[model samples]
Target: MKASLLSAAILATAIVSVTACKKDKSTPNYAKADDFMASHAIKEQSFSGNAAAGFTITGKDGTKVTFSPNAFVDGNGNVVSGNVTVTLKEVLSKKDVLFSGVMTESNGQLLESGGEILVKAQKDGADLRINPALQNDGARVEIPKAMNKKDMGLFVQDKRQQGGATGGNQPQQSPYTWNPAPYYPFGNGPNSYSFSLPSFTWVNCDRFYSDPNPKTTITALPAFQDNNQVTDLQVMLVFKNITTVITLPYDFTVQKFQSYQNSLPIGLQADLIIIGKDSDGYIQFGTQPITISANMHIDAPIHKATQAEVDAFLATI
Candidate 1:
């Protein structure tokens, strides 16, 4: 029942209060950000179809994907046929991006993401793949225009390092990175950005963050109740002047969340948000307005948050 972000200008104060407001009866005490997202973010949609006849599926947000006949192939290079299940998860907003923990970047370059979608198919219980014959513009994906898609190109998940706690319980994480997606012509229609995807994986519509402004590194410090007890906190930089969101990774060596070197543009305005679970298993968040300066640092004092409060705050981003 706590509605702090809506009428309260979604955290109107700089360095907003970072103390617990009491856990909402509906919010669970989760120890990991992955667990929180799995329970609360958008759920995947599945459709039953036959690979021999082809099928088309749409997401809850109007994301459309079409699989051609015999498009699915199983391991050992066998073509799958009947009873194939196609799954899709659409991440279209800043809220979805954060809760889903999907990062938008390519080989260390920042991206202003328009949206992202996970397309997958399976036969019975085994994983399937797109036939090599159709790997080049074989399957088509059309994401509805929800946010700005200017200069957006196709990008796909190329690699990701393992995440979770290290041997010493030091929470370790490396956000997955995307690469210049395959040459599957990108088009911007009136209502959607249409492109062809060769295989089943994560596809993102993103544009390289191009700015000539002088860049610098930015660091964030999370206010921990126990001083330095590491939790599942997630920190992100949300740009006010442009549609860009980048997650800051925790530097266990320095005990701070930091971004890429020479990444932030000097003089640009932005809001830094730190939200995740506490060591005690309660959801907490902090927000502060900031102007990028040379070697800038931010100290975010996080407070308790309910599921509803989390949703409202994400909507504003």
Candidate 2:
């Protein structure tokens, strides 16, 4: 716990302010950490095609998506035929996952994710759905394969578990889990991982995190000297040796960040990261290295940082 907490403390210190900061519409001085994250998020790739003929588009990141002919249907179940638009948001790396933030856990079990993608379609100013009967398998998606693991299976993200903030865009900070999917990916060699569309919202390649060490909970406290300056706060755990990342949910009752009970492997080495948007719209960050231990309460630091510095740290991940 101390190991992860220390890292969080370090990240809390990298606070940066800029006119470019994003503020929530509801509040004048308040900005959400999620909004900050989304501001620097990876750009979405868009494509256009007629629903009757279908189309395919490849993202700069090498994510390939195909829309089969008559693949989409209206809310009334009528086959859509006019020009349709599609957007793809691909998260292929650990840093990408942090920004897109499709969390890695299901039923309290940690997951190791390879990649994730959110695909959506629009027709004539309205949303559309995949026609499962005609295009369940016809809607093919291929994500660039970075690391291939035979255990890496398909999973779907559930927004219902997001603890309410499911309306706008994907919540940057949610404790949702990824449900294991029966669908499998082909082309597991080197180029990419290919699979048919299972369900749209969010999909990824993931497997349960395995370890022989005992598991325990870790606690992190990002005690900013001027608590009033902080608005949106986020605590994160980055596994050093494994391809896994976790967003520690804040415990309002205790006024600190905490991990899932018995979710972390004892002796596991991880870096704790804390990020918050100050009331003035400045972004703060800190990081520290820690090794898991029993009954730990890690403390963090408070310092200023620049947007360049923050981007540098994210690039290292």
Q: Highest lDDT: which candidate?
A: 1
- Give the alpha-carbon lDDT of every model: 0.74, 0.73
Alpha-carbon runs more than 4 Å astray in model 2: 1-39, 147-151, 159-175, 183-187, 225-228
- What is the C-alpha lDDT profile of model 1 across 1-317, one tens digit per residue? 36756657656542253323432334454334455567767788988887888888888899988878888788988877788988889988766776667776554457888898998888778888888877654478889889674767888887643332122222234545777764778888878899988578888888888889998877888875444354666898878867677788777877778776676778988779987665656677778889999998887787765566666666677
Compute each candidate's TM-score over C-alphas: 0.80, 0.80
Count clashes in each candidate, considering only residues at least 3 apart in sequence or on different chains. Answer: 0, 17
Q: For candidate 1, what is the TM-score?
A: 0.80
- In Å, residue 310's CA in model 2 sits off its true spot by 1.4
* Alpha-carbon deviation at 277 in model 1, angstroms: 2.1
